[model samples]
Structures are given as C-alpha cells and as structure tokens.
Target: MQDKIYFIELNEDKKYEDYKQYHSLLPLEKQQKIHKFRYDIDKKLSLIADLFIRFLICQNLKLNNKEITFEKNPFGKPYLLGNPEFHFNISHTRNAIAIGISGNPIGVDIEKIKCADLKIAKRFFSSNELEYILTNKEDSFFYEIWTKKEAYIKWDGRGLSIPLDSFDVTGGPIDKMLRMVTIHGYIISVCSRQDFNGAWCMELAEDSVPVCLQKIL
Candidate 1:
C-alpha cells in the first residue's frame, strides 16, 4: 500500500469546548488521558492526535472504530492491537500535528520554525550535522535536520534511547529513506523503511477535519 502522511493545522481560535465534541470517539483510557492535560491546547492536541490516527486506521483497514484498539511498545510507540503489518507514527508542535501510516514502518515529525539555538544543536547533534547547520547558518536548516533526527529516532522505534548524535541525517544511505518539506513556517520530515516518493506530505485543511472524524465518530 502507498504510504499516507498528513498534517492538520490547529485552529487556535477554536476553544477546547469545540473540540470536546469529539470526545465520544475516544476510548475511556484516551478520554481520561485528555482530561489530565492542564491547558486547552494540550487537551486538543491529545484529543485530535488520538482520534485522527484512529480515523485513519479505520479507513485503511475497513474496520469499525469500536474494533480498533491501541497498545504501546516498551519505548512508547503505539501500534494497532491486531494489525502487525500496519505501522504509523505521530508528532505535534504548537500548531500542527502530523501522522504517517504505511504497511511498512513509518515515522513523521512536524515543528514550528523558531530561532535556532546552536547550543542545543551542539548538545544533541552529531559533529557532521552541527557543521552543516553552522556552515549554512540558517534556522530553516537547523529545523530541517532537527525534524529528520526526531523522525529518524521515532522511525527507529527506540525513541530517545538511541542518541541523536549517533546518526547523521545528512546525505547518505539513510538520507535516501527520508523526505522533508517546509510549510507555513513549519518544517516536516518523514522517514520510511523504503524510500519516499513525490509529495508524500499532505496538508489537511481545518474544514476537512469533521469529514474525517465522521468516518469513525
């Protein structure tokens, strides 16, 4: 199956009460998790990320929303309960959430572009990665590599147990499996066990969200 990668820009003006309408779609466990968040934005992120993936899974597997269940690996990566072949990963920043799904292992990350901190880069980035960022001296490049490393470890499925500095996302064999693009002041990166193709990243408008939720709601 072709890989699926999608991102939705969060509508800041919409209050948490507006998002609370979708709570019925969540299992008790997920609902409780959403309730634990102190801020409305955090609650919305938790709710939408959970429901969005479920919607995608149900659509791809032709399963009912009630039939879908989730379990996490030791590293905290979530997987479909009975669907071993289906792999997906999710990441969210202040205003966007991204999800990637495929028959093969898949991971994706999105981050809002901000001021670059070379110190953080020095601490977590490999020597070669630091050089590339420093050489170009661009925050965009910093986020470009940052998102890739985040996507790589998420794709690697070990989470932060694997050091970010240990791997180089700069051009190499591993880079071949990665794809990245910038949109609306944010950078997104996707990684797959197989090479990525053209325009794999899709931006979902806020208006289409209700339509997606309806499938599983």
Candidate 2:
C-alpha cells in the first residue's frame, strides 16, 4: 500500500464559524454532556474540533452514514474502532491543525510559536540540543526545537507524560520523508511509517475544498 500523509491548515476565523455549525449538528444531550465547561466559547470550540475531525475521517474513509467510533489505547492514544489496519493522528494549536494518515501507525503535531522563556529548553532537550540552540544565536530557535520534540512525543503515543529529553533527534534530518512546514507563525510536522519522498505542503484555505478519498490506504 502507498502511505502518504496530507497536511490541512485551518483558517482560525473560519474554524470558529465551522465550530458554530458543528454545535448545531450535535444532539442537545450530547452537547451538554461534552460541554461541561462554564465558558460557552470553550465548550463550542471543543465540540467543533471533535466534529471537524470526525467529518474528516468519515470523508477520508468514504463511509456512507456509518458513524466512526474511536477507541482509546491504554496509554490514552485514540484509534479507530475495528479498523486497526488504518492508522491516524491529529494535533492542533491555537491557529493551526494537522491530520496524519497511514496504512500503519502515524503521529502528527502542530504548534503556534509564542513567547516562552528560553530556560524551559533545559527541561525537555538534551544537553547537546540545548548547546546547539545556544550556538544557533537566535532566541526563537528554542520554540522550533520544542515543537519538533513535542511532535515526536505525540508520534510516540505517550503524549506529554513522556520526558521530552529522553529521545534525541539531533542527527542529520530527523526523517527522510518527514515534512516540516510553517504558516501564520506556526510549525507543523507529520511522521509516518511510509516515506513521503516528494510531498508538498497544502493549506486549508477558506475557499479551498476537501478531497474525497476512494478508500483508506
């Protein structure tokens, strides 16, 4: 099977609008059950993100009226029910979103760069990694390193519970097919078991349309 990872960049403003539509689609009970937060915006955004993911999965899998159910692993990683053959992962930051798909396991992460203390690098990066950042002579470089580390951790399926410093990706390019793309001040990475040797970055624009997959490969 040919394994390919596609990147989707959501319009922050448009996503909020889409979230509103999603809220209307949910049953009242389901909405109330999931929207435990006191803040209405937070509740709606959470529900909308979930709905958007489900819609993407349904479209990708070409399921006609068949609901997609997710099963959580022991480590809290979520996978599709009864479809172990197809694997996927998702990550979203304040202004960006990413979805990773493969015939085998895959992980993806996207993060928006914001002001952060440089000292935090010592906690998640190896001594060599920290030293490299110091030598790079740019203050913002730490956030780049942080995003890459977090993406790897998410890819590992252990989430933030795993120590970021334990694994080192300092050698050469992290992965031959791994694509690193940036938009609207955010960094995104997608990792998969198959090689994406010539993949090009695609953005999810307000006017852009979604692709229809014949099947999940």
Candidate 3:
C-alpha cells in the first residue's frame, strides 16, 4: 500500500460561501467546530480541513464518506478509529491543508514561510537545530526545521510533553523516514515509519476541495 499526501489550498481572498457544497457532507461535530471560529478564514479552513481529510479517507480506504470515524490518542493526535490499518494526520496553515496517509503511523505539517522571531528557535530547538536555522538566515530554512519538528512530534503521538530540545532532529533515527517538500510558498514536512523516498505531490484543491474530489480519486 502506498502512502499518500493530499493538498488543499484556501487562499485569503476566497470566501467560505464558495465552498458551501462541502458543508452538507461534514458531520455535526465538524460543522460545529467550523462555526466555532470567529473569523471567516478560520471557519473556511476548519470546514475545508475536516471535509478534505474525510474525503481522502473515503477514497483511500474505499469506504463511504459517512463511514469514516476518528479517535484521538491521549495526547490529542487523531487516528482512524474504525479502520486502524489506515493511519492519517492533518495540518492546516494560513493557506493550505495537508493530509498524510499510510498503513503505518504517520504525521504531516505545512507552514507558510514567513519572518518570525528567531529567539523561538533558541528556546525549543536543539543546539544543532538552532545552529542550522541561525546559520542559514533564510525563512524557508527556519520553516523547514520547524515543520520537521512539528511533524515528528505528531508522529510520536505525544504532544508537547516531549520537549523539543531533548531530541536530535538534524540526524533522525534510521528506521523512520523524514521528508520535506515545497507547496506554493509553504514548507511541508512529514514523518512516518514506512520507507518514503520523498515522492509526494501538492496540487491546489481550490474549487475542487468539496465538489471535484470524487473525480480526483
């Protein structure tokens, strides 16, 4: 079984009404979460994220959209509760939602490259990690390390309890795969137990997010 990652882009200027077709497919819980957001963009992101992940699960597992159910680990990492053989994780940044799927444990993160405080690097990153980010002075470099660390923590399934500085991300363990890719202006990263050769693609879900995903699958 091949591991796959799906991409959905929701740009800032886009309105939530444009994707209203997806709302009916989202469960009550997801609908409530989307409505909980005070901002329109947040609402759309939440809405698109929930439906897109469910759509991916249905296609990959060959199950009906309504058949998908999820459970969270103690640390709040979500997994496929009904179909344990299919592991998945989702991350959403300002403009995109990334979903990772595999037969084994997996995590994926995507972040738009932007200027932020470098001091954050000093606080949570390992010395080597800090050095790498500091040495490059590139926004992409900082985001690459940040996304990698974020993905690793999600894969480990033990959220913030695992101190960021405690592990060496520069040279990750051999058994699992660590990979990074670029989508639009974002730095996307993923970690999984399976052997991934870093062959993942990103295409804008744009208008296709809710309507055309069946054709996509």
Query: Model 3 — TM-score against the truth?
Result: 0.91
Candidate 2 C-alpha error for residue 169, in Å: 1.5
Candidate 2 residue runs with Cα over 4 Å from true position:
1-21, 24-30, 37-45, 172-178, 206-217
What TM-scores do the predictions have?
0.96, 0.76, 0.91
Superposed Cα deviation of residue 94, candidate 1 (Å): 0.3
Q: Candidate 2 on 86-160: residue-level lDDT in tens?
A: 787777655455666677677776777667566787776888778878888665566667767766666677887
Ranked candidates (TM-score, high to low): 1, 3, 2
RMSD to native, candidate 1:
1.2
**lDDT score, candidate 1, position 72:** 88
Clashes found in each candidate (C-alpha, N, C closer than 3 A): 0, 0, 0
Task: Kindly list the per-residue Cα lDDT of model 1 for residues 165-217, writing each as its tens digit.
Answer: 88999978779888888889989998887666777778987667878898776
Candidate with better TM-score, 1 vs 3:
1
- Report lDDT per candidate: 0.87, 0.61, 0.79
- lDDT leader: 1
Which regions of candidate 3 fall more than 4 Å away from where they truly are? 174-176, 213-217
